[model samples]
Target: MDMKLSGATFRRAASTVTVIGGSGFIGRNLHRALRSVGARPHVFTRRKPFAHAGRVHPAVAKSDTIFYVAGSVTPALAERNPELVEEDHWNLNLLLWGLRETGHRPLVVLASSGGTVYDPDAAPPYREDSPTRPVAAYGAAKLAQEHALAAADWTTPVILRFANVYGPGQTASAGYGVIPHWIRAVHARETLTMIGASRRDYVHIDDATAALLAVRAHADRLRATPGPTTLNIGSGAPTSLDELHRHLERAVGGPVEVRREPARSFDRTDTWLDVSAAGAALGWSPAIGLAEGLAGTLAATRHTSMSP
Candidate 1:
């Protein structure tokens, strides 16, 4: 069976886009954006992605552009399984060999965590140039991978240090997402817990992908010029967990019960972002507000979520 993108799509997907772990939340959303631009996205994953099973990699590394989005989050996952995380990050470097043979150095977009890339105390909103003092295994691993990409001689490396991303279809389980968790807790009549009330800049995935595509538009110019550009893609304003909860309540149309858990020892007090570089460089800024984004996400979850 021929497993190629359609003829019309071929024009846009000419330079095959490989998104490792593209089936994951961030990657799936990014793939949607890539398709909109007529880019054929091959999701390199262990399992077939929901809609694009054929695009699943039986053997990838032959693709043109490779976006590495596979990694573990949650402190427990990272703390208890550091070796697996390290291996995943290390394997990304191996892509350099295949990328080298393609003749065209594919544009590489790394979905790094903006909320943890820099020390919270150094600046009001974290910047790429800010002093980085990652306190968790997850942050440390991402930083090390960024260093590896820098040294790997990648054709064009754009590091998107992303803020806490929340939108529809985001997992509301114990592992991730602030808004959905609240929605679930509210729906379940469980407790909505806030740890440290740590402030963070939240970017809707729609806005996040817009920021990424903006960077891609400049990849050619960026490749000709040496130097990997590190950008923080987020809304500059910081919203406290408490504030986010208030917004969540309004969006869900409810007054949910609340509980405060003692701040985790590893948790950063607050880590908003400074997106000036992305704005100045890529001319991208997040347009979705908290309540509006959350409201949309809530409606979307009703349709897409398994539990509802």
Candidate 2:
């Protein structure tokens, strides 16, 4: 999807925007995109940990919108160390308190997880109104943040339950992005590891960023709505491990090695999203298909590997 937003539209949407956790994967990309479109973006990293409300108050005081992308742990990591979950909640409360102290009720957009925040046994293609039964600590933490935002009447909350988002610049971290990890493994001629027969709905980073911009552009309507707006952001298509392997091989122009492992206790068998509401609400839909996105990511991975 195109990253450029019309100047007139941005002017109408917001002037000063604050991105918490601006150094992370999604936040970094969103920060760059916001700059490209001529919005004044203020970034607050986790380096300081937002310990003092005085420090965060100024950053969000006059902002028209705030994107909360801050979180300490992934699902797998959170499972190992559940203490991080409490820390995550505390950090958000600090941000909320800062906003309250400043008396600024900006449109707050939260980056939530669609993969972990749904009932695993309910059904596939979970919707915004679907029952939330987070099996892991990470999912529970995200849901807690959602509840916090919903309870904060001063701010307009827009919770985006994002499916697995992968694209260029995503690092090959453990328990993070399978696509990037597999692509890196292919480049290095290493074995691609598969866990069980899990399937996931992957959305491109461009599409994810576009969805955030769409929320920003629709800030007025969202604020005018009765309550907090929660929407799913994903491709709405599930791809199994075998299917992803085929696509990756095609993208790289060769076959790669593979190794299968037993599924972890925390892993869900399948996860897809029903993104129709996000489409209807924000006029947004996933533009990059899995194959196309994989190919682009492969090219990027190759370039990055060769870079000095």
Best lDDT among the predictions, by candidate number:
2
For candidate 2, write residues 1-308 as lDDT tens digits.
35656554556544778898888889999988887777768888877454463356565767888999988788788899878888888888777777775565689899999999999988989999889999988898999999999888889999999999999999888778788789888888899998889889999999999999889888888989988999999999999999999999899888888999999888889999999999999989999999999999999889989999
Off by over 4 Å in 1: 1-13, 48-62, 305-308
- Clash totals, every prediction: 2, 0
Candidate 1 least-lDDT 10 residues: 49-58
Candidate 1, residues 76-149: lDDT per residue as tens digits?
A: 46667878777767566666544555555667778888876687568667778889978887788788888877
* lDDT (C-alpha, whole model) for all candidates: 0.72, 0.87
C-alpha RMSD for every candidate: 5.4, 1.6
